[model samples]
Target: MKTKNNIRVGISIGDINGIGGEITLKAFEDSRMLEFCTPVIFASNKVIAFQKKHFGLEVNYNGVHEASQAVEGKVNIVNISKNAPKIEFGKETEEAGKYAFLSLKVAVEALKNNEVDVLVTAPINKHNIQSEEFRFPGHTDYLAKELNGEALMFMVTEDLKVGLMTDHIAVKDVSENITRNLILKKAAKIHDSLIRDFRIRKPKIAVLGINPHSGDNGVIGTEDDTVLKPAVAELFEKGIMAFGPYSADSFFGSDSYKKFDAVLAAYHDQGLIPFKTLSFGKGVNYTAGLDKVRTSPDHGTAYEIAGKGVADYQSFKEAVFTAIQIYRNREEYEELTSNPLKKASGNNR
Candidate 1:
């Protein structure tokens, strides 16, 4: 059972061959983590035991048949599978992908059923975790389909938040993929997420340009002038407090990002490169504008350091913390907005 302070966190074990298990276990090594939220790992107890032995970790876990059976102050394992997949370090295998999907599927179901308060996913191998049933580029896309609301990949930290206009698409297709409607939709998502999830009353958003110097008045390209600029103007006029078609090259370099609450980049690399460079080990990839909260570490499955037991779990721990914070923020926001009269009286006081 979860208390007001302790939320149930549903965790999907990403790629059995990667650093998911390592980071997950490492984060829970500190017993203080359990004081805030009950963790429900969607994997087998045997697998977790194997990981513990391999990593030489002494953390104990409670094995249960379902997430609802999870108890506070303990790491709970919801044994989703009887036969645990073999762990092959630093390799992307079909078996690893299978189990990864299984873990994610069950965890998502629990989230939809309201059995879990929030979800913190470990990294999954984008190549191996593909099938007839599961055919999305990443967690954001799949979650958009499963959950209610439009999904935006909002990479966040204490001081920085970056959202992508286009994610998991080829660079050549980026310009075509980014349209006026797309920019409006993504920017709106970012604006709402900052206000609702981050507790920002009003958010200023920066949109990065698509071309060099934002097309340099059509000398380099026309997309920025024709598409991005107009979209940003429309957003601003509609009271979104959005600015830019700012040159991507100099925006972060000049520390212009510090002026805004969040940034909406044209593409994946445009946003992630700067985000990772600045806060790689401390950032959380939050799926914003979703009915439920889902977050992951900024970094992916570090295959090279998968089974070495030296993988940094700071980002994973931060992901957990961010998810919990956002969940609480949403709860508070809903409570305050549910009754306008109460909100008005409280405001007057």
Candidate 2:
């Protein structure tokens, strides 16, 4: 890892035709962003130049051949390809998918080697970015394989955090997937992330039920009562402050989610719909439980507004900030945990 003050942030430009380039450039236009971390964008200079010209933005960068050459306090462009693909705004092409994968592959390598302290990815089109090499549904699935630990799709804001028990799966499979072990694993990941990544001690987690109204005493579904309830009880017994199988329908609408440090929803839409509805432009999609820190904007490739310079860059900027904060928090967490007596005494303070 780099020095604490000079953490290197590796950025993989998402689909070339989308708002990835615009938002990324816009995020660093403030110049004060350099004080937070050194950004290494994994794309060619030609690609970046085209976006800069199109958006009419003035953000300077240092072009380099590799992440190792990235300099502190300056935006660095790690040239992955010399031949820049043709730009077709609001359109998805096989060429765009190829370059997207190339950028992501190189960036992940840099992350694995610790050339970059953290990764802040822009959104990619899931349908277009599919190939023989990249066969996963989304970043979370792919990252779980490339990175060290189980990946948890954690959508977060300062006051609200939501994690998915089963992501990128059909609704029909959600009930079958809600087993004791799955609940335990996801709950444990959320619990650990709250402490290490968010620096929340003794974090309270609420798990939303699999069925409506928590199955209404087994009328709608038995999985909530048979599987989810028991699993949550197990988590509590294991010393994790997890309580739930709470009705998903009213969890967020009733302001019940605000009571806990985080909420683990049974499936994707169950968690994300409410999360996005509440914190769409501001939320950061953090891949928690991974050895390396990774985060991305909550929104996707807004093809409808691509190249229009109308897409919001706040989420992308927040993702970058969140990745840096999580990296520093993990460092602090490791140091504190390494020294038991010091941690104990510090807790007392």
Give each prediction's root-mean-square deviation over alpha carbons: 1.3, 1.1
- Error (Å) of candidate 2 at residue 145 is 0.7
- Model 2 TM-score, all chains together: 0.98
Instruction: Give the per-residue lDDT of model 1 (tens digit) for 28-90.
Output: 998989888899999999999999999999889999999999888899999999998889999
TM-score, one value per model: 0.98, 0.98
Per-residue lDDT of 44 in model 2: 94
Per-candidate total of colliding backbone pairs: 0, 0
lDDT of each: 0.93, 0.93
Worst 10 residues of 2 by lDDT: 1-10
Per-residue error at 292 for model 2, in Å?
Answer: 0.1
lDDT of 1 at 33: 92
How good is model 1 by TM-score? 0.98
Writing each residue's lDDT as its tens digit, candidate 2 over 230-343 gives 988999999998997899888899999889999999899999999999995899999999999999999999999999999899999999999999999999899899989989
